[model samples]
Target: MTYGPDTVSASQPLLQLRSLSHSYGSVQALHGIDLDIAGNEFFALLGPSGCGKSTLLRSIAGFETPAHGEILLDGEPLTALPAHRRPVNMMFQSYALFPHLSVEKNVAYGLEAEGRGKAEVRRRVGEALETIGLTKFAKRRPGQLSGGQRQRVALARAIVKRPRLLLLDEPLSALDRKVRAEMQLELKRLQHEAGMTFVVVTHDQEEAMSMADRVAVLNAGRLEQVDTPVALYAAPRTRFVADFIGTANLLDGTAAAGGILLDNGLVIAADHTLPSGAAATAVVRPEDVALAGAGTGTLSGTVVDTFFLGGTSTVSVQVPGLSAPFTCTVRAVQVPQRGSQVGLVIDAARTVAVEDDRAASRPGAAQETVSS
Candidate 1:
């Protein structure tokens, strides 16, 4: 499926950041961040609160100045331009619609401020309303519109200017769960139709994975990983990335000849190139774990809990040496009873071994990736 505009050039990036860094008093909010965004790609900045995603977005939108680094748009320096002068628009989470103005007028506000002629403003306003599917509601005020409709109006206003770049700060956080889901699809469709580059900041992992062509995960004011959603989930580069992007069972162990040797003397076979005796983590997903009859798999454990989730059930198994229970996803009909002894069969091929981040901090330590 196409995740971005149809005609994007591969040679040159539309936006570039060179060692971007920002600080708040003594605390650093953004480390030296370097990123590139294609012309019409939908990119997401994802992380937990205080990860500096919002600061990065604000820096790009000219709302905040970076302490170090340069911002470039289409290879043009943008550090000197003020927010109002830059050819970019930001959609705030609040939807910021004027209560007194009609829908068409709200969308036309930017064009009017630019001193466009009356005929031109009328033409653009009509087209913008039609683009957002609000043409019939042009006469109504923001107070009369639904939350979703107000969001669409805000989107219309942002795109009506035909800015070179569009920034969204948690645009869907204000909507309910159902409406938020519906709007995620709507946002993708709108991006494709508008054919403009979009950069969204969100703390929700699902939202970022669903809508963005590529995602940059941030942690503690630094970028953990930047990749496509599939790659980010399947082959996370760091322990932080593996844990943050999805639900992963991180088995801490020492790297042996061909696998990770857990403290309990269980050697989980995995594909990795780490040096022998190095600290490593085995990343396993719940779906890759299978529950077999006792003594028939790698390790045996007692089922402590079972959670039924419609088509599937999650069985939490309490092993002897592990502090946290190992979770396995099985078909609802195949769920075993609690307290039943079962063997945990891990899929070796699907497993990944990543160097422990803590180990990397030690002197003379190195990091390695899982081999194919």
Candidate 2:
């Protein structure tokens, strides 16, 4: 279900942002950043609010000029170019459709503005409508179309110009969950058929993970890490990334010989290079943990809660000396009842060791170098 980074060359990704830094007056929004977006790829900028992912996207789209560094498209500098002059189109969160204009007219608006002949505009508009599966709704005004149809119209409008790169800012946020999932597939299909690079900015990890070829996670205006969704979830390079990307039981620990020594008196065997006694956190995802009988596991805990999610039940077990409960997914038949004592067993090979979260990287502090 996961894909690798685009085959586009890193040296000449369709778009690139180098050493970009921006601020809103005194409050800095983005730190020095470098990123590459391959052509014909679906790339995502993912992070929590206030992390500057949006600012980075806006900078590339020419909505906000960075205070430092350059924007490059196919090796050409774009920092000085006006947004309209650039070979990029942004589909805003609102869909920004003209209610009075029919879908076909709306899709042709951009081409018409550029003085594209009626024949060329008509041919492209028809193709884009067909591509987005909105050909049947071409004569329908925005007000008459469904939410999903409006989204398709917006996409069709944006791509009708055949821009070198498409910038989408929460393009699916407006739709309901069911429709959102459907649109995710549609968007992926559209991107492949259009053969244009897509740079989407979203805070939703699931959205980014499900849609993008590669994702860049940002924190405190700096990049945390950038990789395929599988790599980011399976092998996070930093503590923040391991915590933010997905559900992780981050146990405070110290690096010791052949393993990490948890503060709770349990040693989880892991391969790490950090010197012994150095601060560390053992990153254990719930799926990698198993619940066993009281005396047969790595650590003992009492089941505090169980949640049934169809095929799996998530059991929350409270361990001694820990403030929060350890969460693990168990098979429906293997779930323990509340108040039952159980032991926790983690898959050591699946566990990752990273620096402790207490020593987080801040804007003015030295940060671990994250690959882009």
Candidate 3:
């Protein structure tokens, strides 16, 4: 599910944004960012709102001009090309379908603009409709289609052009949960069949992590990290990234000679090196945390609440000296009881250590990283 340095190479990048910088008046939207998207790979630009993922997507689509750096497609400079002239098509979040146009006409619009003949246009439109499994709905207008159907129409239109790259800007955000899940698989299948590169922009971690071949995480206006979903989840390069991508139990402590010393007088062994006395956060995932009966665990806590969700159970534990409650996930059959005292056992080999950075660096992150 994840690839390391041994599996990925930098030999060729289909789309490269080199030292890309963009601004609006006095506000900078993107900083000196550099990225490479491999050819035929489904790459995602993922982050919270105002993080500039959408701005970067538009810049790649030729909608926004960068103040500095270059946008290259297949090693060819595309910085100067206009949106319509570039071999790229974007499917907006809204589906952007013309209310009066039928599915077939919508899919054929791009071919018509490109001046394709009647026969070829019909053929491509039919193929595109079939590809998205919307051939039966070709005669229906936008108003007559469901959210997922409209999304398929937008996708068909974009792919009908056979563009070098497809840009999807939160294309599945408008759909319901069940529909969104189905669309995710459909999008992945379409990408494989087309064998074209795809660049997606989304704020949903689940969406990006589930469908992308690789994900590029953006913070503020800078690129924080880029790696496969599993790699990003397993070995985050920075604290912000570690906390942002997935649910992490971050315990702040002082780096001592042996490992890290928690404010609670607990010491946790770390695999990574850190200067003694340096401020750091020990990153642990809930699934990796084990609960033991009192006196049998490294740390002691009382169960405050428990939630049973079919396959997994989440238990919130209240520990003294910690700013907030910590949560851990276990098998549904292994649920913990509220008000019961339990010991916290963490897997040192599976843990990671990151230097604590500024606040607001990782959106939705809990403040006050672990305490003594």
State the weakest 10-residue window (summed lDDT) of model 3: 363-372
Candidate 1 C-alpha lDDT tens digits along 66-153: 9999999888999889999988899999989999999999999999999999999998888778878999999999999999999999
Residue-level error in angstroms, candidate 3, position 295: 2.5
Q: What is the lDDT of residue 332 in candidate 2?
A: 93
| Candidate RMSDs in order | 5.1, 4.1, 5.6
Give the least accurate 10-residue stretch of model 1, judged by summed lDDT. 363-372
lDDT of 3 at 16: 85
TM-score of each: 0.94, 0.94, 0.92
lDDT of 2 at 210: 96
> Which lDDT tens digits does candidate 3 get at residues 233-309?
99987787988998988888878765678998888777778888888788888888898887676667899999888
Q: In model 2, which residue pairs have backbone atoms overlapping below 3 Å?
A: none
Ranking by lDDT: 1, 2, 3
Count clashing residue pairs per candidate.
Answer: 0, 0, 2
- How far is 100's C-alpha from truth in model 1 (Å)? 1.1
